[model samples]
Target: MTREINPFGLRMPPELRELLKREARLNGRSLNAELVARLRTGSDPPDANDPPPRGMRLRTTAVQPRNGWVPTDAERAMLTVFRKLPPEKQLALLTLFE
Candidate 1:
């Protein structure tokens, strides 16, 4: 089945457009096709190995405790729950919480 699309204009850097075009070719899809898939899936932007117009990579850094940091009421409740968990589970939870 075919989908109907309306043409639209967007303004971006010329370099970015060129990159998208390169990427579209590498993926064996037209620029419009790649754009449609990206919009439909709501996936993260392409990586460096992907065609050039890749946006920035998603960044996540582990939380670190600061000096004199104090846990709030919510955190205390979470800590109580953590206590109920086994040691291995506690470590895993800490990894996410820390």
Candidate 2:
């Protein structure tokens, strides 16, 4: 069975947000995932030498079939958020991601 987590609103300094974003990128995680992990671990992030847990994003090669990959629950939630964006905002986000 799927566990439901309630959505939360967070307000933080822009610098802290950027720091988390950078850490998320380095750790191959979404920002929310990184934050949750940090919170659960009492602020110490996982060691950089450790292997990323399963379902963590990995860089793909030409031999991999990207389209055949399944989306993670976090990705699905983000997609839902994306879908709710205004058309121009959606396009802008698409451009940003691309």
**Tens digits of per-residue lDDT for model 1, 4-98:** 75678889899988877765665567988877766754666433233222231222333344454655999668646755775446445545755
Cand. 1 TM to true fold: 0.39
Best by lDDT: 2
Q: In terms of TM-score, which candidate is strongest?
A: 2
Estimate, for each residue in 11-76, the C-alpha lDDT of model 2 and write its tens digit: 999998987786676556899988877677655544433433322333232233335655689976
| Candidate 1 local distance difference test against the native | 0.56
Measured against the true structure, the TM-scores of the candidates, in listed sequence, are: 0.39, 0.41
lDDT of 1 at 25: 64
With candidate 2 superimposed using the best TM-score fit, by how many Å does residue 23's alpha carbon deviate from the native? 0.4
